[model samples]
Target chain A: MMRVEEKLFQNRYRVDGARAHIEIVDGDVCAVHCQDKPCTFCCPAGCYAMDNGGRVTVITDGCLECGTCRVICGEHRNVRWEYPRGGYGILFKFG
Target chain B: MSEHFDAIVVGAGPAGNSAAYTLAKAGLKVLQIERGEYSGSKNVQGAILYSDALEKIMPDFRDDAPLERHVVEQRMWILDDESYIGGTYRSANFSKPPYNRYTIIRSQFDRWFSKKVRDAGALVVCETTVLDLHMDGRRVVGVRTDRDNGSVYADVVILADGVNSLLARKAGFHGELKPKDVALAVKEIHFLPEQTIEERFSVKGTEGVVIEMAGRITQGMVGTGFLYTNKESVTIGIGCLLSDFKKSGIAPYALLEQMKAHPAIRPLLDGGEMKEYTAHLIPEGGYNAIPAIYGDGWLMVGDAGMFVNAVHREGSNLAMTTGRIAAETIIDLKARGKPMTARHLAAYRKALDGTFVMKDMKKYRDVPAVMDKNRQFFTDYPHLVSQAARTILTVDGVDKKTKERAIRKEFARTRSTLGLFADAFKLWRAFE
Candidate 1:
């Protein structure tokens, strides 16, 4: 099985290096509120992860723009999700 | 001062393009806005183009469309852990000209569609995000874009925005989408040589095959998987309900990995190199979960209205049909000098109800709920059915009747007789 990063490598993206389209409103919400960090698992791109320091971080570069992370995080409602700026983020080669 | 148009169509996917094309061809001033770099840059689907729908919109589309392959065969599979029981339908009639359906890559197909929209005289703009709806009190009048001084008024605003339309929710048009209402799907397109594709799929020049699968692959989730063949590539993917993924704690990508590893599936993609992987949400809420489709100056088409018939795995057709009908409704209303008000726009819903869009949705309205409650259908049934197949087919010393009785006993033991009967009734009612 290919790693998610390896899988995403085949796709194209014009990254908005400075601006993150998806934001974790509260970094500690996952540690304090969530029993199971669903976003880390449910995100198709595997964009969100809780590191060894007990902090949840989101990388927007590989984001599929699917909006799954926000919906599945109903418990904390901490994902401030939005589409990237026009012409940025994912560009499907053979969508 | 912002310019006012006859109609503002949002999103450049199938639905939006359909509306903009129809209105433009009717000589109405139309502005079609898309957030992508190009028409299909942000869209993805299993993407089987039902010619009937597009034919109604543009009768001669086949002459110049960016089609991949025409479908001549369809396979429906019920997969177990290692084996699958399925049926195939291949028809020579489907091989004839004016093909019933064709496989398409959404990005290229959408570019072609937007070209048609522009050629029809609709003003198609890309790389511009529609931030919100411009409303007078509760009635939508136009759209607010991300651009400076981007407020543009239109007599009718068609929301062909895709499933994750924040505009629909922010404008108080619909409530937040429930987890069960949407399925999160991940698909990868594998590139193979044209000859290799044709040889593997047992098809020749421009012919394609589509395999829709169910049972076990979704890991007991109320979802399905699919594999579609293109001219030189094959697209394979799996999807489950958002709620199911949350509960099962299954990683979305991991599910696809398991599906790709299936014995019945893996061999076909033996040497193909994957070129693109994508993930998107599908509106699977069916008829009952559909929001207020038409109100005041706005109409919601495509997945925005939850128009997908998940039972048949058909969405683009519904999107195209709803879009065309909505545009037609607006054109008719304008011809009669009727205002695009809530009362007048009810015709759009009426038009849809009279078409297969609403009728098919209504017929399978109970499907989502049935699949939601019946976890056994995705789990136990596959094992039971496969076990029965293995038992009845193997040349054992046992007699045929004895094997049949053993199969029945196994079913009764796995799911009590009463439970089995109730399950059958539920399935019947859901499909009925």
Candidate 2:
């Protein structure tokens, strides 16, 4: 199995360390209402992961910004998604 | 201070670039905003450049467009777990000068196209995000950007934003896209030596091959896998509906690794170095899902408006065409000195309807629905067809008639005779 992290390592991204373009609007919705958190796995970049507390956590640094999490979080509408302030996200070397 | 222009084209991908290029060439003051570091930094595609579409925009594009290869052979394969039954159609005509299609690396290609837009007199702005539509009642008067005092007024606004068109959604142009409406695709570019690529795919210079497959690799999901030969890299990807991925709990990356591991596909990228992996969504909802294209002081183009013709694996062409046509419509309005009203902009729809874009879309409008419901087409047919091909091709002592019977019996047993006939009929209706 190819490590997705290694694959993402080959891509280029300029992280805005201060801002998160996307976040779960409510942690409770994810912790309680959301079961089978698809975002934890659906993200091609593996940006979303279950943390030690079993809550879905997202790190936007590795995001390719495909908007998979925003769309897939249809039930709760809990994912607040936005584009990183213009030059601050995934810069595909070979898009 | 607020900036004003005759037109504002948002998102500088193929559609936005095409629209801005055409509008600025006609001497309209156009402001094209892109969210990426540059125009193409956010775009991705399976990426076959249709010459006819670009030819309509810039007939001399082949001279310098960062093209990788001109496709000379097209292969369609149906894969089982280990085997694929396939066919190739290669022609000398495709290999000749003035080629039909070329595989493009979108980042380089879009950068080139965006430069052309800038050179054409449009004030192209990069690293700017359009935060919201500045509306006058129901009319989209301009856009509010994230920049300080970034409200840009325009006579007209063209939304050429790519697939995740949140601006349009936020404006209530269309409802949220259902998981069924889009397919999430992930791709990788595996770099190999130019000579190695030529030797492996059996082509030299600019000639390349494209292989498209549908089968068990999707794990009975409605999806396909593809490998395209670039100059020194191969673009390989697989995609299925978001719903399927959600339902099956199959990670798209895992699916790609499995596809790369397929026996028939492995050797082509056997020793290549994979450098970039990207993911994007393709609007597969066909014609039916196309939202309202024109509105008062506003118009939508490309993936934002769901203009992709998915059945034929044609999207970039439709994007460029729609972008060009939208620009042409606005230009006509300007010549006659008309307001950007819905009635006046409706001409864009009529013009698009007159082209092959709408005709082809109408032709296969049922495909997404048909293919979505019929999981067996992606699963059973690939296996049975590959089994049949292998059954007859093997050099064992089994007689030809006996082998044929064995294949027939296996098919009938797995999917009953009635099921097989229904599938044929469904295929005819869906594709025809």
Candidate that would win on lDDT: 1
Query: What TM-scores does chain A show, candidate by candidate in order?
Result: 0.94, 0.94
Measured by TM-score, how close is model 2 to the native structure? 0.99
Over the stretch B340-405, how does candidate 1's per-residue lDDT look in tens digits? 999999999988999999999999999999999989999999889998999999997999999999
Stretches off by above 4 angstroms in model 1 are none
Q: Show where candidate 2 strays beyond 4 Å.
A: none
Q: What's the fnat for candidate 1, on a 0 to 1 scale?
A: 0.83
For every model shown, what is its TM-score relative to the native structure? Answer: 0.98, 0.99
> Each prediction's DockQ?
0.85, 0.83
Deviation in angstroms for B64 in model 2?
1.6
Candidates in order have lDDT scores of 0.92, 0.91
